[model samples]
Target: MRNRTKSVLESIVIAAILLVLAQTFLEDFAVLIGWSWNIRKILLFTGFFFDLFFTGEFLARLYTSVYNGRSARYFFAERGWVDLLASIPLLLLSSGPAVLALLTGGAAVFALGGMLNVLKVVKAVRIARILRLLRVLKLFKQIKYTNSIMAQRHVAKITAMTVSLFVMLLFGGSLVVSMLGLPSVDQVIADRHSQTVERIVSEMPAESREARNWLAEMTDSSDLLLVKRDGTTLFSRFDNRYYTELFGPSDYQYIPREGYDFFFDMRTLGAIQSKDNLIFFVIIVVFVLFLLIYYSPHFALTVTDPIQVMRKGIEDDSYNLEVRIPGRYEDDDVYRLADAYNRVFLPMKDRSRGTTEARSSLLDFDDVKGLLDGE
Candidate 1:
């Protein structure tokens, strides 16, 4: 995984993710606005390209990671596990059993492919359910769930749907994951401020008039303002923000998490306004988001690639002390790891190479000394 190649692959996958998520979000909006834009067919068609690209990217990194000596533990950690669960099976849909079926022309592959096709049908149903969620939003006129969710009376079904959406679709299929994951907006917020959210929820009362007043303010103005424990201020636009349940439903039907409440706005017009924001604005936003999601995880690749190279080098007995990680790796824990490996193994390798030569030299010296003694 050269830096350049790693970057390109990440860019591709991230770009694909954004495109898919945008399509997903847009489709939701389109349904809300009652537009029949055929976004579904278009999204499905585009999904194939994304799936193929990501599948290749996933396999490449997996091989490189395994090749480099990543332990089962390291590989199964948060980052690796997400890549494996989210990316690999989706990839296998096209490459794994289907391809195997073609190559071997075996009944097992056929059975596997048939089962996968069934899964695909289930996936379509889930997507349809996702689209149906747009309808549920219509129920939130003032502050209520038209339908009971999770059998809880006050819980907005839409709120429940969003939570269920994230979880079910996470495991539902690759397409669902990409469609939901790409926004990466909520994901970033959750990760960056999870502790803050917990703290806020714990400290704040379930019936604080101030919090209730704030929720009213959020609804009246169509935005939620949150100042975190660190005093880092954050806000969510009613249009841009998606809502889900954080806890048992009470005054918090649409609160997505403890840290933030869903800024409810009835108009599904979205953040889009009349001739104000440009196409460039949207692109820049997407690009910035791409940079965030794109770079955060790929930084791990920098650590793993060098390890792989070292693994290959050692296995081949081609000891190269010149195997320096090209960029700034000095402060990285992985860098210290690689340095330590070289220190212990390289010296031993050098000694092994000198072993026979040293024996031969000693024999010559002994022979000379013996001859001199005899004379």
Candidate 2:
């Protein structure tokens, strides 16, 4: 009989890992693409949940394997190591910086936005979060067929490919971030004094000629000038104080409009330079989809048939000449598993073919020995 408890726990682990990988970058993604802040709550909740669940699951499995005499194999097994990388590193990476931020009292995380050089260690370890992709393989461990298939030599090859994908993703994401997140050299610092002038004018008392004069006195001369749309000057933060002395009449222009009113137009927009990054995004997405499609079909053909044959042997409580699976792929794991399975069962099937002693075989269920050997 299948262990339902183990199966359900494995399924939950798979679900949590999927949630973490899917939602991990959502906050940064929203900022990059300028999405609404409404999605931040959903992203934060899922991120916290998946990190906690994976951390607990990893600890439980680590302790159980150690206590159960499989400590070396548990930590060294393909599945075991992948689970370790996918869970613990992610838990620490997501939480450590946050804890440090809280302990140091109300600053942004990531060493309060990379303030401390020592905590740059967190940046180096952040790379391991990419290994969380390996958690996808854990879902297979619940299915005996897919589990065995993934445990084969192909694991090394898949790990290499996953690492390569990680590199490409990081490169592409960094390119996008430079374009969307970083400040340009020519970007202007908005005039803070203009904001003060707007607030003072809007909140002026019912009577006071001195109110408007005080606004001019309070603001600095190289700051932004506030002007009405009809060419009437409201106040000169710059032009009235230092007009034509440090500035030319041709240097400034009155732009008509909203809140902050008028401002300088100095900028070196990098939009044109980042055109290739968008193209790279499309290419990488298509490349990943192609890789998935190429390998997925091999699972159905190589894994399902052999496992079904073995499962039926246990379910029916007897072996028979019928339903024997022939090996088709010599290099594949399923072929090896099925070949071993056929060797064990073919002898039993042969003895039954010549006898009407099947009831005796049913009574002697203990004959099933070494069935899981070498799996």
Candidate 3:
């Protein structure tokens, strides 16, 4: 029962890993593919579900190891570290600081701004899940169940190739896409500034005092300057900064409203376009994943099934000249091997029987002759 439970959980984990891989590769193009934004939420939910499941599995194993007084074995020998990694939703870890920054305001906002940059770097740590993909090697280990050594080798080799191909397409394609699709640093900064402008303008407070308070609450007090068309300052917040640095910095946006032109410096905004222009790569990955999954079983069957059948028949004493394997074609290597085996085996069996019968006949004649002499 325990083994059955383990098998079921392992199967679920494998399925989850595949789903996560598909989700990760295809997520960037979700909009292009006509999937609603809600798809992202669903994916996130499922991702959390799988993470929780893996975490529970890891804890269960840890508990069992502790009970057996071999907790070190679970951590080191059994790769519990992998389970721990696979379990963690590192992307979710940023939410705490984000919430705190939003609720607390001021210095916490700056801290969140720095953390946002750090999380951009944290996104790369997700590639570490590639190590978790190594868990899929368990599928190769299952090939050992095949009776034929040759069949096991063939299946394992192809399985490894298939896995390597999928991973290469996933990670390598993502890398190429990232390199090609990434915007220039200046472009990114400009985009972030534009986004910040848009957000602040859309959420601009109606009353002057309210607007000033909102601006102060949202970012550094001096980050925004509101000046009239006649160059008279209406609502200006200035702090310890040089006029040269504040006035003509490239990372600022200007918007002309009814009474005033607003100048806002981009000190609060983080990366707003982290993943864009990946539709082409997403399509390639989906197609490759589909093709691999669709044909892999057929390929494995073609390569391994014939050898397994022949080996099993030989073990069962069912393959011979009289009852040979029936699927022989000129181009079929496995059937040709069966044909060769039958020819050699039946000829050897016939030769051994013939020699034994001849020796028995000679002995029978000698015994008869000796009996007559005694008579």
Best by TM-score: 2
Q: Which portions of model 2 miss their true places by more than 4 Å?
A: 1-8, 25-28, 98-115, 118-128, 143-375
Predicted structure 3, TM vs. truth: 0.45
Model 1 sits at a Cα RMSD from the real structure of 23.5
Candidate 2 residue-wise lDDT, 201-238, digit = tens: 46644334554465456554434455342354455555
Off by over 4 Å in 3: 14-39, 55-303, 319-336, 346-375
lDDT of 1 at 257: 59
- Of candidates 3 and 1, the better by TM-score: 3
Q: lDDT per prediction? A: 0.42, 0.49, 0.50
TM-score of model 2 vs. true structure: 0.46
Pairs clashing within candidate 1: 68-308
TM agreement with the true structure for every prediction: 0.29, 0.46, 0.45
The local distance difference test score of model 1 is 0.42
Worst 10 residues of 1 by lDDT: 245-254
Worst 10 residues of 2 by lDDT: 265-274
* Superposed Cα deviation of residue 348, candidate 2 (Å): 14
Better of 1 and 2 by TM-score: 2
